[model samples]
Every structure is written in structure tokens, then in C-alpha cells.
Target: MITNPSTSQLVRSVSTELRAKVLPELTDPALLVEVEMMLSMLDMAAVRADHEIAWMMQEADGIDTALSEAAVEGELPAPVRDALHALQLSRPADLTYPEVQRHYGLASEALARAADQAHAGDERLRSLAWSLLEGRVDHELATIGAYVAVGRSENQT
Candidate 1:
């Protein structure tokens, strides 16, 4: 059986073609800047297409884990507690992007509260919340690094 090109592959091909063919022929500085921005966005999208869902799920799972741990040791704010209970009852693996995003929004609020509590002297909860936040930031930074590397390579070539 034959399969079509994956989304990332298609995006990479287009970005490569634009860089090698179209970019050189363009004379307008403004148009060149626009095209370059488009290329960078496409590159970022391609990277995300390859990993965003997994990252989302991973993030959700981490939030769930942190909430569960926090629940065992201390009291969470009402909104966070409710959101965590809802998350626990649902299957995260079955969630779509929008659903995950909604849950993530709730988790963010809960995390913020957790951070506040942590600063108020709850070291255990603070550690868990910060771990989740740090992991997320690291993931984002990796994606940004990939885009920056692509931009650097384009500049070099």
C-alpha cells in the first residue's frame, strides 16, 4: 500500500523549495522578509506537527500526576480540585486538542495557585508544580531551538 507524504515532510519540502528557488529571485526586501517569516512559521509548524499531540498528552498527564500528588498531601483550591477530579474521571488519551487545551487552561490556573501555596511555605507542592512547569518550558524551548537552528541554516546557505 502507498501512503501520502506526512504533513511534516510536505512542509519541509515546501520550505526547502522556497528557500532554494523562490527566495533568491525575490527583489523586494519587504517581500523577502515576509517570505522568510512564512518559512520560519512553516518550519515551526512542521516541528509541532511531528510532536504537538504527544506533547499535549504528555503535558496533560504531567498535570494530572501533579494534581494527584498534591491532593494526597494538601488542599487544592476549589477550581483546581474540581478540574482535577474531572480530569481524573475522563480518559486523557481520548481527548482532542481543544479538550486538552481546556483542561490545560484549568491546570494552569491550578498550577498558579499551587505556586502561590508553594511560596507560602508548601515545599512539596511547589516542587511538583515547578517540575511540571519546567518540563513544559523545556519542551517549548526545544521547539524554539529547532526553529532557530533552521533559520540559522537558511541564513548560512
Candidate 2:
């Protein structure tokens, strides 16, 4: 019987196979470098596949919590208000990529507008927006993890 492998599991298996088998067979320097990059990409893909959905969900929720308060303050710009309103109206129908992506897109827009408001000296909005921005940056940094350039001649350690 065939069992299902999680995306990360499958990606790691392929990466391991490439490193153990294909790497040994690669004779050309250029091909070795290219294959090393491919292995790095596979690692990245595994990490992203495991965490991207949850990160997006957290970011979306953070935006909603922060911007919902700003919406109540009644001082947001027209575009910002509209974006927030759209977020409120457009709940994700499911956890599918397209559904989550649609929700995330609206949240991103709302966050951008709220960030503009914050920059314009809305103190409460500023703190809230900053937290959201930091959370976004954290997610991005986590996805990138370490950036040691594998197989790049200049980055050889």
C-alpha cells in the first residue's frame, strides 16, 4: 500500500537522493555547482512548503486585529478604510491556496494603507502597524533562514 508523504518529506527525500547519488556522478565543475544550487532550492522549498500557509494565516490575523482597531478610530484615509472594509467583507471560503491568497492579498493592501496612516502620525496606528511589519519581516527572515551561498565559488568556505 502506498502511503502519503508530506510535501516537506518528499522534497527532503529528493534533496537527499540528489546529494547522495547525483552529486557523486556529476564530473563537471559547472554541473556540480548547478546541482548544488538545485539542492539548496529544494531545501528552501521544503521549508516554505511546511510553513508558508501558517505564516500567511498569522499575518492576516495580525492585520485584522490591528486594523480593526484603527477602523474603529474613524480617522483612516478613504483608501485605507476601503481596504479594511474589503478585508472584513471577504472572508476566506476555505483553506485552499487560492482562498487564502485572496484573503492575504486584501490584508496586505489594508496593511499598506494602515502603514501610510501610521507614518502620518497616528500614534496608535503606528504601534499596531509596526508590529504587523515586524511580524512580516520575521516570517520573511524565517523563510530565508541562513544565506550561505552553497556551491558559489565566491562563497566557498
RMSD of every prediction: 3.5, 2.7
Tens-place lDDT per residue, model 1, 99-146, is 767666666666777777678877677778788889889878766654
Candidate 2 worst ten-residue window by lDDT: 148-157
Judge candidate 2 at residue 59 and give its lDDT.
89
Candidate 2 per-residue C-alpha lDDT over 1-157 given as tens digits, one digit per residue, 9 for 90 to 100: 2167998889989998888888988778887888888888888898989998888888888888777776686677787889988988888898888898889999999999888878987776788888899999988788777886767678542
Instruction: Judge candidate 1 at residue 154 and give its lDDT.
Output: 63
Candidate 2 displacement at residue 23 in angstroms: 1.9
Q: Candidate 2, which segments miss by more than 4 Å at Cα?
A: 1-4, 119-124, 153-157
Whole-structure CA lDDT of model 2: 0.83
Question: Can you give the lDDT of residue 106 in candidate 1?
Answer: 62
Among these predictions, the greatest lDDT belongs to 2
TM-score of each predicted structure versus truth: 0.77, 0.84
Against the reference, the lDDT scores of all candidates come to: 0.75, 0.83
